[model samples]
Target: MKKFSFLAAPLLLISSLAGAQEGVPSPAPTPAPASQKEEAQTQLVVLETAMGNITLALETERAPVTAANFLRYADEDRFDGTVFYRAMSVDWGEQPNGLLQGGTQNDPKRILDPIAHEPTSETGLSHTKGAISMARMEPGTATGDFSIMLGDQTGLDANPDGETEDVRAGYAVFGHVVDGMDVVRAIFASPTDPYKGEGWMKGQMLADPVEIIDVRRIDSPEGDEAEPAPKETNSAEAP
Candidate 1:
């Protein structure tokens, strides 16, 4: 048998493989799941409105108190027939921080007890586009009312360099719109009743509030074998 130069042959094979892969990029790795528990515990809630269906991914893990409060109303079907009463619209399409507000009507019978305030400082979520935050009169008065951002509003987040806690404190952002932003924008652009709101909220009230037909907690559309996902029925009813 001829001399088999094992070392030289292996070196040649390695060089050939390296040459073949010289310009090729490696495949990207898949992102790791947030957590095993988050996968099963996080929840979705679909709000059926006259315009369309708006799905929200409530961050129960981050803001337990506030998220649970919203769930209470949703689970009890109290959001049904509620209207998108206010849309703080501007003439320009660049509503970088404009707001749209609505929630269960001020019916004492349907309202639940106000929960303790969960500031954005504690939650670590910012007021970015698609963000949904609880609306309150003072610090701890948030209940049924909520607001959705049409554009980024990081200013609404807790300011780290403020003199007082109130100055740094911000609204609790428990969830965000996962789908149907077109519907949210349409509601934002709906004509306003110039004479509806009182002081600062004047002219922000929707001329015709878009009615919410149903609001219910839904399983992940990603599909969990334990439960069936609710079919998203987009409401096409004319306003």
Candidate 2:
């Protein structure tokens, strides 16, 4: 198990300048024709961690609400200073498959209200490698936390209860991890253990905590124009 020193200071900081207003969802630009949707779904997001920087392009078409929610948090700066917190890698005979989870700490005001679950039926987004999804104990319980599956995670998308004709629908998948998957794999390989007797842990935890440092939205070219810059003034020298 590789151990990363828990350095409080971040090695790099990537600033996302988009501004998000409360109670106002970011507008979805006009939808592209069917042919263009595939190419247009990609969104770039940079994750500046204590270890290194990881970039991701979220799949908006696959998971609109999930993408919106994530962007909302970034716009609000809710994830600033949060930690990666959870990482797991399954080592079976086959290639390792697991996920990395992170989110805003248990801050009441910062947590966004839960959004409705959009499983494959609604979004057609499968739990494939590099996918990003919300981390919730059960349906309708997701708040600020989210996770990115390192490999196929079809099991997490179905419902656990058999009452529904559909398979056990689990967590709601929102986006995909298009880049920096290596960083995720590294986090999964970090040393971890069950947080003995801790709340919500149920005895499962990461011994060496991975901190998030901060999370902010990557501004689009248009959004970047909205920022206010320092005023430049010319001074005259006395004759």
Candidate 3:
């Protein structure tokens, strides 16, 4: 995902297509930060999908606010019917690198408010392979949408030297794929829509989106789940 540069205002509304291409706050050092994971109260979310089960460990200790935001959606059952619609393969080239994008659509009826910006510099998290992060057009636009790095992505991490007009802030990595990376691989290798999408995202949208059956918290007591809202189809409908 592209880190925004010119936009002065925080993108209050993160794009629902993928995670908002923005970043977060906290510190998740290398080697998985087991201590930080525990302190962050890192929790797991099991995603039962058409492909298979994919479990993620969120870094709540390092990125509390961002992790809580993601967990809330899972606990509320808001992700049940959503689809993993975007896959940015190495073949797609520079901008997105290797990754998969999914989450809520820009449906005003169901989307929550955008959270504050959390730069990776602030979080001390890097966009390493298997790391999960939010997406946004501008800082603070991230809502329910997110991206998972398929490979090491130092490019998506905040610039250590300095933030420039070009580098901007990077994506907030709040979790990692603890299990079911094979499932993620299978989905990534799937085809993309030839006729849909535009610009850099053109031809990057999945031809037949992988449906997210359910997202639920595995580490703590969850709240009453609401039935999933219907999936959005027109935006990606085949001609």
Candidate 4:
């Protein structure tokens, strides 16, 4: 296993899996009723980037607050003209694994108020391949920045018994890429600037950032307009 470390902003910190502390696992919870076991409501959105379109299905029912926040930005065109400014490549385990970061980059004019931290433990989400998550300096501070994971990154999941805040709270995962992962993979493989970012973010900044032309909700697979189910509670804090 390889270990990675991240500093708070520029973006959220990613802890090294090798250094993760071992603790007693918590007992499993009772299963939800069959009605509640139905798939959560989701919203299909396409991120039209300079490279290509990456489609995402936001889990609004599971991670309501975070999903709604993202929807608001897309609806208002706050993500237009933004760039995928960072790419963190993971060198261990499988090939072609890491994450790409982008968004409003906290542009005061484009970003809205910060939302609450929605740990994966709470939202039942994980930083799996093609997951779309938020980027923030601390819990409850994520605004417009987000990351699209390129591989299974459950290492970023919340550890309730973790030794530190970042580990304990983990990062929120509100959605996953439903299509166009090829576009995401291509962006993750883009060139990076050796001296562009500060501290841990250094060498991870994209040399020629991919521009995010815009983001918008798409019709469901069934060819009907899909409305996000109202979920006021539940998830972020990603790279």
RMSD of candidates 1 onward, in order? 21.5, 13.4, 8.2, 7.1
- Cα lDDT of model 3 by residue, 1-239, tens digit: 22212122211112433433333332333343455334555777788889998888888778888998787677666677888887866633343347788887554444567887676667767777788888765668777778777766656665544344213565677989988888888898889987867654678789999999889767532333334334443222211
Over 4 Å off in model 3, which ranges? 1-40, 91-97, 160-168, 220-239
- Give the candidate order by descending lDDT: 4, 3, 1, 2
Q: Between the candidate structures 1 and 2, which one is better when assessed by TM-score?
A: 1
Q: Which residue pairs in candidate 1 have backbone atoms (N, alpha carbon, C) closer than 3 angstroms, thus clashing? A: none
User: Candidate 1: misplaced stretches above 4 Å?
Assistant: 1-41, 90-97, 163-165, 221-239
Assess candidate 1 and give its TM-score to the true structure: 0.72
C-alpha lDDT values of all predictions: 0.63, 0.54, 0.66, 0.73
**Candidate 4 Cα lDDT to native:** 0.73
For candidate 2, lDDT tens digit of each residue in 1-239? 11111111111000111211111111112233565445547566667787766666666676677777776666555676777766645553235566676776445656767777666545655556787767653446566777777666554444334343223444466666655777888877777776532433323345666776655445441222123223223131111
lDDT at 239, model 1:
17
Clash counts for the predictions, in order: 0, 13, 14, 1
Give the number of the best model, judged by TM-score: 4
Model 1 Cα lDDT, one tens digit per residue, 58-176: 88888888988887777666678788887754333355336777785455655666779887667766667898887754457676778788875554555545444433555577889
Output the better candidate (2/3) by TM-score.
3
Total clashes for model 1: 0
Worst 10 residues of 4 by lDDT: 1-10
**Best-fitting candidate, measured by lDDT?**
4
